[model samples]
Target: MRVLVLTKPFGALPPGELAEQLAQAGADGADLLVRDGQTVTPDTSWRIAETAKALRGNGLELRQVSTDLISADSESERVIGHCAEAGVSQVRVGFYRYDAELDYAAGLDRARRGLASLAELAARHGVRLVLALHHGTLHPSAAHASLLLDGREDVLVHPDPGNQAKEGGEHWRLTLDVLGGLDRVGCVGVKNAVWEPDGAPGSWNCRWQPLADGGVVPWATILPGLQELGYTGPFSLHVHYPADDPLAAVRRDLGYLRGLRSGPFQSEPFQSEPFRSEPGTAPPAR
Candidate 1:
C-alpha cells in the first residue's frame, strides 16, 4: 500500500515546493489536486507534465489527480490524455450534486449518463476515472457509489472516511463491509474530525483533529480489513486540522498512518476470497 499526500490539504504551493514537502513528509506519492492559486491546473497540459516529472525526479509517484468533471467528450479525452502523459494511473472527476429545483431521480440519471461518458474517455487513454463519495453529492453513500461505478473497470471509487463521517457518520466497520465488498475501491482518503456538542438546539459542530486523535475513522480496524482484502491502492492523507504548523501536522499524521498500516495485524495471512459482509469478523490477525 502506497501512502500519498492529497495536495489540496496543503493549500497551494509551487510544484517544486510541494514535491519537497512530500519528500519531507515521507510520502511515497502525490494525489494531484489542481486548485486555484496552485502551481498546476487542468488548463495547461505542460504544467501537469512538469509537475509529474518533478515528483518523479524526487522519487515520488503521481498516483491520482483530482479535477473538475468534463461533460464534453473532447474535453474529457483531452484531460485524460494529459494525465496519461504525466504518468498518472487515475484521474478523479467532479461530483454530481442534488439540486433543490431538480428531481432526485432525474439528477441521478444525469449523473449516471455523465459518468458513463467520462469512463469511456478515460478507458481510451488507459486511465481509470475516480469518483469520490462526498457529502451533498448524488452518490454520497457506498450504496449510491456502487450504483454509479457498477460494471466499469475503467472507473473506480475514492472513499473518504472523514467526509463520510461528516455526512452520515456511519460506522467504519459497516462502511468497510459495504465498500470492501466491492472491487472498485481503488483509493482511500483519510482525515480525522469529531462532532462537538454545540449550544444550538439539535445541532452539532465539527472539530477537525489530527489522525487517530479524535475522529471515528477506526484506522486500526479498517487497515487490517483492507489488507485482508488484498488492497494495494494508495492511502491519501488529507490535512484538515487547524495547526500553527500545517507541515508538521502533515508529517505527524503520515507517521501515524504508516505505523497503523504496519501494526501487529498487518503480518496476517489474507483470504483469497472477496471481502465478506459478515458481522463481527475482525480483520485477519493471523
Candidate 2:
C-alpha cells in the first residue's frame, strides 16, 4: 500500500502549494479535497485539471478526489467527468445522513435511486465512486456499505476505522472479515482514536490520535489482514486532530506506516487462535 495525503489537514491552498506541502511531508500522491473552501468545488470543474497539472509538475500523482454528498444526478456526472478528464482514478462521494424523524425506508429508496444513477455515470466515465464508512450515515460498517452498493462495481467502499470508532463503532475484526471478500473495496482511510471516560459514569469522549498511537484501530492486526486479502490500494492518511505542526505529525505517522509495510509484519503468518497445534499432529486414533 502507498501513502496519499488527503490535503484537508493543510487547510485551503493553491494546487501548486498543496502539492509542495504534501511533497515536503514525504507523500508522492494526493487525495485532493473537492469541498467548500478548497481549491475545487462542484461548480469549479476547471480546477480539477489545474490541480492535476500542478501535482504532476511537482512530481506528485493525483490518487483520488473527495467530494461532498451528491444530491443530484447531473452534478455527480459532471464531477465524474471532470475527474476522469483530469486522469484521476477514484472519487470519494459523501453519504446520506440518517435522521430518525424522517421515513427511513423512503429515504433509503431515494438514496439507492440517486446512487444508481451516479454509479451509471461513474461507469461511463471509467471512474470509481467511493462511499466511505462514516458516522450518522446510512452506511457505517463494511457490511452495511456492501449492502448499499449491492451489485455495482463502479461504486466502492472506502473503510475508515476512526470514523467507525465514533458513536456506534463496529468490531474491526468483523470489518476486515466482510470487506476482505468484497470486490468493491477500492481504498482504506487511515485514522485512529481512543475514547476517554468522561461526563457520566458510563459516558466517554473520543480523542483522535495519530496513526499508530491510537487504541482504536489495531494496525498490527488489520495491516496484515489487508495484505492477506491482497489489497493493493492507497492508504489515505487522515489526520483529524489539531496539531502545532501538521507536517511533522504526518511525517511521523508516515514513517510508522512505512515501517509496518516494510517490516516483518507482512511476512508473518496470520493466526486466528491463541494456541497452535503442530501440523499433522494426531493423537493416534483418539
Candidate 3:
C-alpha cells in the first residue's frame, strides 16, 4: 500500500511550507482537510487552485481534498470545480453524528441526501467521495457506515480503526465484516488511541500513539487484514497527540509500520491481490 500524510498535522505552517515538509518526511502525498471558522466546508475553485499550486511547488501531489467545510448546494459546486482544477481525485465527506438521539429513519434519509449531494459534486469534478466514519457521530461503526452507504455505488467508506476502539475489540472484526464487500473504498487511516484504565480518571483521556505502542487498536491484525481485503488505497498517517511534535510522532509511526513487515514477524503479504484492482476493471473514468 502507498503511504500518505495528512497536512493538518502541520497546521501551523503555511500551506506551501507544509507541503514541502510533507515531501521531506518521505510522504508519497497528502490529504488536505479544509476548514472555515471552526466548521469544515466544501472546496472552492479558487482555494483548490491556489493550494494545488502550493503543493505542486513543493513536489507533492494533492491526492485528496477532505470536505470539512459545511456549505450550501451552490457553494459545493464551486468547491468541486476547485478540486478538479487542483488535480484531486478523491474527496472524503463526513457523515452525520451517529451518537445523537434522533429518528433513525430520518437521520438515514438526511445522510442519504447529503451523500447524494456530495457524490454529485465529486462526479462533476471527476473525484470520488469517501464517507469518513468518525466517533460521536451517527455512523460511527463500519456496519453503520455500510448500511448508510447501501445501494450508493458512487460513495465510498473510510473506516478509522483507532476510533473503533470506543466500541472495544469485538467491533473491530465487525467493522471489517461491514466494509468487506464495498467496491469503492479508496483509502484507510491508521491510528491508535491509549485509553486510561477503568474508573481512575476524571475523564476517559485518550492519546494517539505510534503503531507499535500497544495502543487500543491492533495494527498487526488490522493492517494485514486491510491488505487482504483488497485495500490498496493510500495508508494515511495521523498523529493527534497534544504536547508532542506532530511530525516526529508521525515519523515514528511510519517507522513502526515499516518495521512490522521487515522484522522477524514478517508474514504473508497484507493483501493477496496482485494489484489494487482486477485485470479487467479499469480505474473510474475521469
Top model number, TM-score: 2
* Model 1 regions more than 4 Å off: 73-75, 171-182, 264-286
Where does candidate 2 stray beyond 4 Å?
171-173, 179-182, 264-286
Q: For model 2, name the residue pairs that clash.
A: none
lDDT of 2 by residue, 54-119 (tens): 988888899899888464466676778889999999988877778889998887777787778777
Candidate 3 overall lDDT versus native: 0.68
Clashes of each: 0, 0, 15
- List clashing residue pairs in candidate 1: none
The candidate, 1 or 2, that scores higher on lDDT is 2
Q: Which 10 consecutive positions of candidate 1 have the poorest summed lDDT?
A: 266-275
lDDT of each: 0.77, 0.79, 0.68
What TM-score do all the candidates reach, one by one? 0.85, 0.86, 0.80
Candidate ranking under TM-score, highest first, comes to 2, 1, 3
TM-score of 1: 0.85
Task: List where candidate 3 sits over 4 angstroms from the true fold.
Answer: 37-45, 69-72, 169-174, 198-205, 228-230, 264-286
